[model samples]
Target chain A: MNITVNWGLLAPILAIQLILMVTALTSLYKADATRGPKWMWVLIIVFGQILGPIIYFVVGRNDRS
Target chain B: MRQFGLFYRKEMLEMARSYKWIWVPMVFLLLGVMQPVTTYYMPEILKHAGNMPAGTIITMPTPTAGEVLAQTLNQFGTIGVLVLVLSMMGIVSGERQSGVTSLIFTKPVSFIAYMTAKWASMLTLTAAAFACGYAGACYYTIQLIGSLDVGTVIQAGLMYMLWFVFVISVLLLISAWLPNSAGVAFTTMAFIMLLSFGTSLLSRYLSWSPSRLSTIASEILTKVETLSSVGPVLWISLCSILICVMLAVYRMQSQESISAKA
Candidate 1:
């Protein structure tokens, strides 16, 4: 069970995921209105991994703003 | 031409404003990286599953670089297609609902120009994002798995992109026909899934279908001999895309007349 983890190979994947999450969260914060409640989106963005932000961007955010 | 340029610029600006410029490529990059990393880590993952009896040996063969790249394309075929479709589903329908289309049409803008402008911008964003993703996938696949022939990779990528172009054109056509964004997304996805499935099930008869582009793309990556037969599929795809754009323009024109009559 002692497989050595290579951070070099894993770092870029982690960074990209972080960037996606942060971008979605920032957009959600700045959005004037959303399809659903703000707190719910925050929870989804935090917990939803790769798909959470995509759903928020696609369906959650209201386009008027 | 001037109106087309103006609309293209505005669409690009809107893409940037909505953070699609950031997130879509990031999503692509993420999807691209996940394939190689997961493939490399599969053995370790199996070990960590913690269900095997002690000393139960598991042997997994390492996949070649071309195979890995082909798998990456498969990833894109599924989730990548869904993301692009969702991002673009509302492009026209949203505008129509919010009265933006009416505002633009009130000007001297031609329907063909408007539709082409939208098509061009969507294609641009898609190309940029896909290139970013595919580059990431290639870099990691070579670094971790093995080296691939650059020429084959590029050829495979272009073939895969034809599939994207066909899907985007379909999106534009559906968006023009439907006033509801949700309906547009649903119908477009259904159309894509049915076509892809049908094409594979009837490959002998449907070889010229644009859906065959994805299969040809993976074949090119795996070093299969497909080049001799790629012509008809390519030309048919290009023709289908042109027809989709024209039909969409005609549909929008008819909708405007209906509204005018009301």
Candidate 2:
């Protein structure tokens, strides 16, 4: 198997994923409260790939104020 | 105007504090970029999924840059709009339900200022996020698929943004008029879906409908339609937004009595 994965093509996708992950983690770290348990969110953020961070950001935090 | 400024700033701060500033645009950006990337990789993705016959060859026509961008807008039209609705459904009704509106109303606040401030912040968020998402999609489309005319993209984007403004205004109006946030979201979604679907079904009669704005936007991108043809629809949409705001302000003003009865 001589499959060549172009780094140039894949770099932006990786970068976007990284940004999402970091943002989710940072928000989780600083959040005063969330919709559910913080540890569950941490696990979801770590393992959920592209959608995990987005779900965390969208539905996890309880923005009551 | 000063009151509007103060309220707008407060709204911005609330958005920032709630991490809406960070996440909303990021989600849009993700949605925008995903279309082109996934389209470019579809063949390889299918191969990896491993249900292909031994000698089957997949030959798919690579979509034009314009088509890829249109697909991105389609993503926005569905999932992106859903996210915006879910996030913003509580902007007015939720506050009312929580008694925050009562506290704010007791102060010497202009109802117009309050409504306009909410409108302005929603517009800013939508515009900024849409611009980021569309730009990202354009960049990836050009790199992976083909070239598209910048002017066409901008015109289509502006048209789409106008449709978004109209939708958000409808949401704000519903949120103000309804006491339940879930009810507000559902009604807004149903209204939007009906508008789009209904107009498409009766295009000849409803050519001037605001829902046609989405179709006009896509047609502009694909070079199948021109801006001049969309003038009536655009004007109607703008007028509808203005009407929505006025109705929202009126509803908010009467909210005191409504809440008292509730």
Candidate 3:
């Protein structure tokens, strides 16, 4: 099967990366997360790249419990 | 151990009573039933539909039992992983937030034992669901197709269960350690998915990273590879589970260091 994608695909990739980066950096503002939550955020950011950080932003960034 | 059993039974009962446990496995059963039932009748069902485009006919390859199994695993496997992660997301975090841990901790039982029992219960449930769901699909396939190699069927079932168990342990570990179970579960699921996609960009050599358990699970269903040939894959899977469990225990103990503001 021949499959192809245009360079335009890179646009979404770059956009997602930026969104993730911003979310990760902003999470420190939420609450006192202890080292545990903070490390988890970093793990999510590095490993999750886009989705990890995005999910953290949506669900975990609060740290409010 | 008896205490563990008593607690396990109580925990199991509690989990069962909540009705949340029904979410994923039941959906998986539907996926299983849909496999053979859909493949057996999809053409006829489509043909019987009310609207038909003139001169346009829906044509598909006559799906075999293998194809049905493949389709079921691929589809159910993806959704199953998501559901398992999501449902388990709240188990640990909710307990911590609600002071459930304190209730359990005041007892004479070691924290490790309590965590282990809970982890064991979830792991057992995860394995049972994976087995039952796929077993249903396999049995249905045999009913439709007349015969399949029992050895192949059992091997595939075991492989699939192992794949899912590998994933559940990660969630278990994350949920165990993270202050927020739901948050960790969601993040862990996202992490696995992202890793699966990210590895694709790297090399096919790393394609069998434990995160690709879903892909490998489905593939093992349709292909031939002895457990021995798949040893490296299995080893990585085991290692991943072990590391996750260890980290979770470490994290749980570490949680003690967090000042109780609540």
Candidate 4:
């Protein structure tokens, strides 16, 4: 039984992943520092390399501290 | 518990004082009426527009009650809940931000009682606004596009209600951790979108996920999935709610709001 992976369709997946990760990390740094929890940052960085990270930056991160 | 009723009324008064209740329902009412009327007259509207160009064929399709309901749901369904959530996002966390948490905590109110009152009052307000809008839409839809099947209408109404609840629950959690409602609103939508996209990706492996709960009813209506086939989805929704509520309560306890708006 062969479970062949298609890197072609999966190529966009990598690009998508990269974008998600970068954004999440920036958001983690920038998100509401006073209120946002540590794990929330960690989870975004760890789980959402491109998507999660980007989301963290865009949605979760608040640098009002 | 004795103060819960009083607190509820007080909260209700705050809501009434704001007059947001009036505008929200009025906006939703307009949406409800316009959805069907627009859909009903769309072809005629398009036909008139086509006279300006190389004549495009305009086929007038009669608008059905189901379509009107769908249109109403599409235009303003998820949005109204988000508005309500954003408006009340500061309810719990705001006290902390304004340095009033300690003051409130020092009062006769326990965290559980106060939080419960806050949650309950907000939920009531949201329900009233949502029901008014949805009911108005449904009523006008019946008058305009004819009547929906009673069972179907009821089911759809319930499903729409749950959808709003789902949204509010998410925002409620975000609000607990975040000091401001705008952040909560953005975070809620962003979180939901991320969850949706990521869950869809992971659903290739995991048979059940929270995202499925969102799409299940609509899918069932469209014959894309069976009603009973969505049991796992319901279970997932239950689990998500349980986790979110627990986390939100914990966060509210720890959240030291410092008037820090980002």
Which is the leading candidate under lDDT? 1
lDDT of 4 by residue, B153-185 (tens): 666666656656666677767878776656777
Query: Across the candidates, what are chain A's individual TM-scores?
Result: 0.90, 0.87, 0.52, 0.55
Query: What TM-score does each of the candidates earn?
Result: 0.97, 0.92, 0.71, 0.69
The candidate scoring highest on DockQ is 1
Write one digit per residue (lDDT tens) for candidate 2, span B153-177.
Answer: 9988998999899999999999988
Model 2 chain B is weakest, by summed lDDT over 10 consecutive residues, at: B222-231
Model 1, residue B42: C-alpha shift (Å): 0.9
Position A53, candidate 4: lDDT: 44
| Between candidates 1 and 2, the TM-score winner | 1
Regions more than 4 Å wrong, model 3: A1-65, B20-24, B48-52, B200-203, B224-229, B257-262
**Which RMSD values do the candidates have, in order?**
1.4, 2.3, 13.1, 15.4
True-contact fraction per candidate equals 0.76, 0.28, 0.00, 0.00
User: lDDT tens string, model 2, A1-65?
Assistant: 33457788778777878887898899889878998899999999989988888788667876663
The 0-to-1 C-alpha lDDT of every candidate, in the order given, reads 0.92, 0.86, 0.65, 0.60
Better of 3 and 4 by DockQ: 3
Instruction: List chain B TM-scores, each candidate.
Output: 0.97, 0.94, 0.86, 0.83
Q: Model 2 lDDT vs. the true structure?
A: 0.86
Docking quality (DockQ) for each candidate: 0.75, 0.45, 0.02, 0.02
Which candidate number has the best TM-score? 1
lDDT of 2 at B79: 83
